[model samples]
Target chain A: MIAENVAFGIIAAAMALGALGVVRTKNVVHAALYLVVVLAGGAAQFILLGQEFVAWVQVLVYIGAVIVLFLFGIMLTRAPMHPKDSLDNDLRWPAAVTALFLVGILVGLLVHTFHADKIHLNGPVRTADITNDIFTTYIIPFEVVGVLLLGALIGAVVLARKD
Target chain B: MLLNEFLILAAFLFCTGVYGVLARKHAVLVLMSVELMLAGVNINFVAFGAFHNDRIGQVFALFVLTIAAAEVGIGLAIVLLIYRNLHSADLDDVDTMKG
Candidate 1:
């Protein structure tokens, strides 16, 4: 119990800090790297919840593919390495206020709804069980996601390819 | 270790992403912010799943992950197209469509 709490605390801190870096950084590549940290911390949070399969998938898909895609976009678009004033717009103060308001509402709602609820770390869901359920009950959505991926691939190639 | 703790953390991340999306001028940065928001939602899904001892939340998370991947792919492609045409990724500069 103590170990779980400690792990959760550490991962949560990392996630928050990484997220801060992602938005606060002036350089685009640095923001991407911070995003990697935030995503990895998210995977750790999944592991702490005893969802190992989801944790690994989070790492593999997010850190492996998505971040790489962001880097490629950054590179191809020629994002500046140096800090630039143009990265943020004039609405920074208004956006900050809105973000704070959103955080306040969400945190208040969560605390009021589930403050006393405790999650059991035992009974970890096996990958096989998830696969079985995916194939059985969630089969249609599964197939739809596959089709979505195919469409995204074709669309990306068509949009990105040079004439 | 409480459910609210995870929920609050997710909220923090989500809010940061919101700020990023609203403040950042670069289109790629905006896309990255969207990814951050999705990550926060994924945390909420996993937390609720574990709390309820149900596998459905995790399954939904997987679907979210798939969709996020596709989103990033197509979104980046579109960003690339914008950059090629405008020679800039700044959202403000892509105002040719504006009357």
Candidate 2:
């Protein structure tokens, strides 16, 4: 239990720093790289939570597919590889204040409500059980998500095609 | 092991994403921030699910992953189109609809 707590603390701190880098970095590519840290940390968090399937899925989907897509967008759009000052808008201060406000409220509420609660990571979640749930209880949503993916694919091709 | 640990981490991530979305001038950066927010939500879901010993949270996290992928696909497509048209990826530069 102490080991798990230490692991979680380290990973969570790294993720927080990575998340900050994602938002605060001057270079777009650097921001993307920072995202990789946060994403990998998320996978670690999932493992610590005893959800191995989701952790690997996160690695495959977010780190693999999504980050690649972001790179393509960055390259195709020709974002400056070097750091720049104009990446932020004039509303930066206001946005930071808003985000800080949210942090105070959310963190306060969560600690107040769940401060004593502990997650019992008894055993790793079975991938087979997740599959069963998806196919049986969540069949409708699963199919809907499939349809959504198909639609998104078609829409992307259509929207990105040259006239 | 404390549930608040995960929840607080998620809240911090979510707020950072919000700041990114609101302050970033680039469209792709905004999309990336949105991804951050979704990731935070996924953490919350998985944490709650684990706390309760339920598989539903894992299932929902999978669904969130699928949807996030689709969203990135479509969002990048739109950003590409905008860049192609305006020759710029800055969100402020694409205000043709502004009165």
Candidate 3:
């Protein structure tokens, strides 16, 4: 549908542009802020794909929690507001070019491999279907992830505790 | 679109993140770059799940979400710890651990 293409195009464009801001910005704080934009854009893209829950998680987790901690760390450290704090050394363009070349090659290879004919495509998994999977087949992993999160919380507290 | 569009988008995001990781010097920026890459992978997982009639991608994404949250938590904590010790978040100034 024309609607899907337009929505996808807009979200994709926003994500890509936000990404450029993330990389191109010299200020670390600004980069962190730009990351919020990128994450939000990605969330919008996810929603358009019909994964409303995932989109909410993307917004809630990345924007709400991760970025808040990121900003807190910046403040705690008195992190430089600008990127000129240190390490102005630049990478050799040739190296950058080669790495980009490899990335392009890898992308091409992956595209060819996951091509449409190769994939037995199915329709978008409706909300009820995903709910069923979450409660039934994925119940174990769902619970296990809680344990993982607990470990992370403990680790964070331990790391932050000052001597 | 098919799986390939998601794959391509993920790849593009991953590559952009990689480039940012490789190119940036500041520690916090590096962390942001890593998160970008993880998000890209998460999108790929969800997309694949939708296309395959499996909920595995969503589960994988949930797992990734957990890891990313933890990663940011620990990363910021370490950043604070490092700042306490070094007074700077510059990777160049972090030579004490290198040699």
Predicted candidate 1 versus true structure: per-residue lDDT over A15-69, tens digit per residue: 9999998888889999999999999999999988988898999999999999999
Which stretches of model 1 miss by more than 4 angstroms? Answer: none
**Tens-digit per-residue lDDT, A1-163, candidate 3:** 5676677777777787877778777676887888888788777766666676777887888899899988887778776765444433366354367558866897789767876632343444466776788789888987887888888899989988977
lDDT of 2 at A150: 100
Error of model 3, residue A90, in angstroms: 3.4
**Candidate 2 CAPRI grade:** high
State the displacement of the C-alpha of residue A46, model 1, in Å, after optimal TM-score superposition. Answer: 0.5
Candidate 2 lDDT (Cα, whole model)?
0.95
- Measured against the native two-chain assembly using Cα atoms, what DockQ does each of the candidate structures obtain, in the order listed? 0.90, 0.94, 0.57
Between candidates 2 and 3, the one scoring higher on TM-score is: 2
State the TM-score, rounded to 2 decimals, of chain A in model 3.
0.82
Two-way lDDT contest, 1 vs 3, winner: 1
Residue pairs that clash (backbone atoms under 3 angstroms), model 2: none
- What's the true lDDT of residue A47 in model 2? 94
TM-scores of all predicted structures: 0.98, 0.98, 0.88
lDDT of 2 by residue, B1-99 (tens): 898998999999999999999999999999999999999999999999999999999999999999999999999999999999999999999889999
The better candidate by DockQ, 2 or 3, is: 2
* Per-residue lDDT of A14 in model 3: 76
Error of 3 at A129 (Å): 4.0
